[model samples]
Target: MTTVPTSAPQRATAPPSEGGHRRRRSRRTRERPNWVAGLTSVVWLAIVIVPIYWIVITSFKTQSNYYAENPFAPPGEPTIANYRLVIESDFPQYFLNSVIATIGAVIPAVLVSFMAAYAIVRGRRSRLLRWTNSLFLMGLAIPLQATVIPIYLIIIQLGLYDTLLALILPSIAFAIPLSVLVLSNFIRDVPKELFDSMRIDGATERGMLWRLAFPLTRPAVVTVTVYNALQIWNGFLLPLILTQSPDKRTLPLALWSFQGQYSINVPAVLASVVLTTLPILILYVVGRRQLLSGLTVGFGK
Candidate 1:
C-alpha cells in the first residue's frame, strides 16, 4: 500500500534555439533605419518654411538694410515703420476692394454650382443633362488668358471697368465649372433611399435638396468654398487687366505700387507680400479643420 504512489511525466520544453531565432528577428527589425523617408520629409519642410521665414524677417528690416545686409541675418532693430506706412497709405482701400470682389465672386459661384451639380446628379440619365455637364467641364479647359481681351472689351462697353463688379463677374464665371465638378461627385454618392423616402413623404425637389441633400453635402460645399476663396482672394491677373485706378486696385495691384519704375523697394515689396499673404494664411488656419474634415467625408465614403 505504501509503494502505490506515482507521478505522470512532464512535457519537454523547446530548446533555447527557437527563443534565439525570435529574438534575432525582432532585433533585425529594430535595427532597420527609416532614414530615407525621414530625411525626405525634413527637406520638404525646410523648402516650404525657409521662404516664409525670409519674408517675415525681411518685413522687419529697413529698406537699406534689406539689400545691404545678409538676407539670412535677423534685423538689428525690428520696426513697425513699414507696416504703419502701408496701413496709412491706400492699402485699406485696396483691402476693402479685395474683400468685396472675393465675397461677390464666391457666393454666387457656390450657389450656382450647387444647383448645377444637383441637377447633374439627379438627371444623370437625361441627354440634356449630359450635354450640360460636358459644357461645364469644357469651361475648365478654357484659359483665362484667351478670354481676357474679349472680357476687357465687354467690361469697357458695360462701363464696369475699374469697379469691383467687373472683377467679381469674371471670376464667378470661370470658377463655376470646377465647383460643379467637385460638388457633383459628392452629390452622386448620396443614398438614393433618402431621396425616395423624402418623395414618399410628399417632399418636392427643392424641399429634398434644401432639407436633406444640402445638409449631407456640406463637406464638399466647404471644400469648394475654400478653394474659390483662395482663387478669388489672390487673383492678380484679372484685376490687373481689368482695373487701373490706385483706389480701384486689389491687394496684389496695391502691393505693386511699392515697386517703382526705377528701383524696387525690396523691403517694402516684401512687406506688402507679407500683408497680402496674411489674409489667406489666416483663412486657411481658421477653416483648415472644416476643410480637412469635408475632404475626408467627401472622398473617404
Candidate 2:
C-alpha cells in the first residue's frame, strides 16, 4: 500500500506528455456554433436558389399560364411545349455559333496568356516585358462598352464584320489581359528552387515550361479557361453589334426571337434561357474543384 502511493502524486499533476489532452480541453471550451454565420449562409443560399427556381419552374409553364398563375407557384400544368418551341426555332444554329466563337477565342487567349505569364514571371529583368505587362494591365481599365464604335469600325476595316471571326477577335483581345494577370500571379507562387533545379538538369526553357510549370499550374489554367468561356458564351453586345443577319446570331441572340414587336414570350424565353445555361452549368461542375483550388492557391501555406 505504501509503494502504490507514489503513483498518486503523478496523477495529481498532468505529465508533460499529456499537454495534448490539455489542448483538447481548451479547444472544446473555445469552440462554439456561430449562429450569425449560419444565418448569413442560409440567406445567401436562398437569394441564389430563388431566381434559378423561378427560371426552371417558369420554363415548364405556358406563356399565358406564366402571367395568369402565381409567379412563384409551380406550373398548374407543366408542359414541355415551351422547350419544344425553343428547339423548333433555329436553336441548334445559334448554339453552334456560340460554341464556335467561345472555342475560337478561348483557345488562343489562354495559350497566349499562359506563355506571356510564364515569360513575365521568369523574365522579370526585361524592360520590354515589364512594359508589355503594364499594357495588358491597362486593357483591364478599358471597358467593352467604351470601345464599341472603335471595335465596329476596326472589324469593318479588317473585313470581318458580321462574322463569328469578328466576335472571336475582340473576345480574345479583351480576355487576354485578365487571364494574363491571374496566371502570372499563380506562376510567381511557384517555387524558385524548382526552376533552378530544372535548369541544372539541362532542360530547355520550353521543356521546363511545358513539363513543370504547365502541370503545376493546371488549376489556374482550368479556372481561366472556364471563366473566359462563360463570358464569351454569354456575350450580348458583341454579337448584337457585330452580326446583322439572323443566320450569324448566337445563343444570346436567340432570346431576341422570343421578343415580338408587341409582346414577349416569357415562358418560351425562359425555356431558351434554361437550355442556354446547361453548357455553362456543366462546365462549372467539371472545373469547380480546380476553380476553388486556383482561387485559394497562394492564400496561405
Candidate 3:
C-alpha cells in the first residue's frame, strides 16, 4: 500500500505589531537633549572662564590703566612692564626654590609609594601589610592643618626649619598616602593570570615588578607624579611657615612680596600668579590623557 506523503509541521508566527516601534519612539523621546544639564554646564563654564580671562587681561594692563579702566574691560594699551618688573625682582630665585622643592618631594614620594603599593597588593595575605594599608587609609582623614603645629616643632628640633628640605619632607609625607591608595587600587586590577605566568617562567617577584608592574602601571605613575608635582609647586602655607628668608621664598611667597604696605600692585601680582601657574598648566597638558585614563579605567588581561 502507498503511504500518504508526510509533510513537516509549520511553525506558528506572531502577527507583526507596533509595540517595538512604539517602545523605540518612547526611548528616543527620553534620549533628547537634557536642556537643564546643558544650561548648567554653560553657566559654570562662563563663571570659570570669566575670572581667568579677567586675570589675563588685568595682568597686561599698566597700573594706571588697571584702575582707570573698568575691572572687566579689555586693556586699551597693554604693557609688559608688569612681567618685566616681576622678572627684575627675585622671581627667578623663587622659581628655582619651587622647582627644587617640587623635584625633591615628588621623586621620593613616588618611589616610596610605588614600592608600598606593590607590597600591599602582592602581600595582601600578610597581616602586617594589611595593617599598613589601613594606616594609609587613616592618613587620608588627617587634615594638614591639624598636623602643622607638630610638623613645625619637629622641623625646629631637627634644624630643618627655614630650609627647603623642611618643605620637601612634609610634602612627601602627605603625598604618599594618596599616592599609595591610587597605586594599590591600580595594582589590584592587574590580572592574576599574568602574575602566575611570570612565576611559571621563573621570574622573581622583584623581576616581575620591574618588568610587569612598572610597564603596566605607567598611567597611574604619570597621574600621581603630575598631581604631587602640582601640589608641591603651588604650595604656599608650608613655605610660609617653614621658610624664613627672602632668598628661600617660593613663587607663592614671592607673589606675597609684590604687595606693599600702602598699595598693592594688582597687575604685577597677577603677572606673577600667571607665571607661577604656567608651569603647572604645561605639566597637566602633557600628562592629562594618561592622568584621566588612570583615574577612569582599569587594566585587564
Candidate 1: worst-modelled 10 consecutive residues by lDDT: 256-265
What would the per-residue lDDT of candidate 3 be over residues 204-224, giving only the tens digit for each residue?
999988899988998999999
| Cα-based TM-score, every candidate | 0.85, 0.88, 0.90
Best candidate per lDDT, number? 2
Q: Residues 1-301, candidate 2, lDDT per residue (tens digit)?
A: 3654444444466465678889988898679677889999999999999999999999999878987999999998999998898888888999999999999999999999999999999975888999999999999999999999999999999999999999999999999999999999888988999999999999999998999999999999999999999999999999999999988999987777655521467888888889999999999999899998988877866
Return the number of clashes found in candidate 2: 0
Listed per model in order, the count of residue pairs whose N, CA or C atoms clash below 3 Å is 0, 0, 0
The residue pairs found clashing in candidate 1 are none
The segments of candidate 3 whose C-alpha lies over 4 angstroms from its true place after superposition are 1-26, 298-301
Highest TM-score model number = 3
Kindly provide the TM-score of model 3 when superposed on the true structure, using C-alpha atoms: 0.90
Candidate 2 or 1, higher TM-score: 2
Q: Give the local distance difference test score of model 1.
A: 0.88
Model 2 alpha-carbon drift over 4 Å, by segment: 1-30, 261-264
Pairs of residues clashing in candidate 2: none
